[model samples]
Target: MLRRVRRQVADTLRVGAMTLYYLARGQRQRGAVLAQMFEVGNRSVVFTVLTLGFLGAIITLQAGFQALRIIGDTSLVGPQSLPLLVRQLGPTLTGLMVATRVGTGIAAEVGSMVVTEQVDALRMNNAPPVDYLIKPRFVACLVMIPALTVVGIASAFVAGMFTAQAAFHTQPAVYARFDVVKLSDLAEGLSKAVAFGAVIPIIAGASGLMARGGSAGVGEATTRAVVYSSLAVIVLDFVLGGLAFLVFA
Candidate 1:
């Protein structure tokens, strides 16, 4: 089991390196990156917004209630939570959502091509499958995930503001404080976003490329993509958060 895990890790890293090499060399399929960006960014906007918005509202409402019960004041709820949202919740939640939705799609698509022998065909034509298949997706994710994170953060803040006002009678001016936020907070969030974006496609593409045994293989690849991508997001979040603390605190 340990050997298998090591092999998988090595494979993932190899794919990631190749993808990065292609990206640095400016190799891409025409229109492929644009299509993937649409799939990753435009298609995901509504889902990210709704999920983060409701989560923000619930968090603020609960915090407000607890604050009122303990101190007869809910004024600090927004000020306290805003920094947490920007530094932790926003990027983390968006990464998990992308892992679940986009990771599965990437794995399944690539796995299908593998099973159907399309990848072999590409190799026969002297086209490196990683260059043709993974690079575009990598570029797309690298560019779009940060954008989605911004949209998600905005949505969550707006929802929290409304919740604070309606549930605790806190004024918008009081709840919308940005003085608590710092450059380190933004840096940490964007770093996580970029890291997650880079990792997801490589892991998913590696899993897909390893697919065998036809349909059953594709199913397993899809499952691995989602599970591994989500785990990567969480682990990266923890690592980046700790680094931010050590460096900035």
Candidate 2:
């Protein structure tokens, strides 16, 4: 059992190293980088924006009610919620959403390729399939997810401000008076995005490559990719959040 555990650990490390190498290679391929950025980031814009907007509205509404109950000042809701949105919720939720959407898609596609023997064909042709398939995805997720997180955070905060104005009848001056620690908050959010982005696609893609059987195998790989990648992102969020607190607390 111990030997099996060690073998698994070693295998995981090797896979991680290979994924990193692929990402580096993909980064140098300008066309692949741009294409993947659009594929991963641009394609998912609607979902991201809608999620951010909903989050903003809900948090603003709830906080306004809570603040009115006690302090009778609804304006504090925006100020209170904006930082929480950007600093903690924004990046983490965005990452999870991407994992569910892009990560599952990647896993199923690659798993289908594997099960259909396309990966074997590439191997027979002396082509490194990882370079063509896995690498672009890893690089795209790392680059584009962070960029999407930035837009999400901004939208959530701004929409929160708007919500405060519309729902609470608060003036823009109330939001303008809010104190946001932009640098530390932005740094923490982006850091979470980058870490999650790198980890999720690799988990999905590698699992896909290991897929076998037929349609069932592809479905299993896709499900595992979504579940594991989401879990990993959540765990990494706590780790990164703790590290940020230590550094910027």
- What are the lDDT figures for the candidates, one per model? 0.91, 0.80
Summarize candidate 1's per-residue lDDT along 26-141 as a digit string, tens digits.
45577999999998898889999999999799889989989989999998998899999999999999999988888998999999999999999998986788999988888899
Return the TM-score for candidate 1, rounded to 2 decimals. Answer: 0.95
Lowest lDDT block of 10, candidate 1: 20-29
Clashing pairs in 2: none
User: Which runs of model 1 end up more than 4 angstroms from their true locations?
Assistant: 25-27
Q: Work out the TM-score per prediction.
A: 0.95, 0.89
Best by lDDT: 1
Clash pairs (backbone) in predicted model 1? none
lDDT of 2: 0.80
Tell how far residue 214 is off in model 1, in angstroms.
2.1
* Cα lDDT, model 2, residue 159: 80
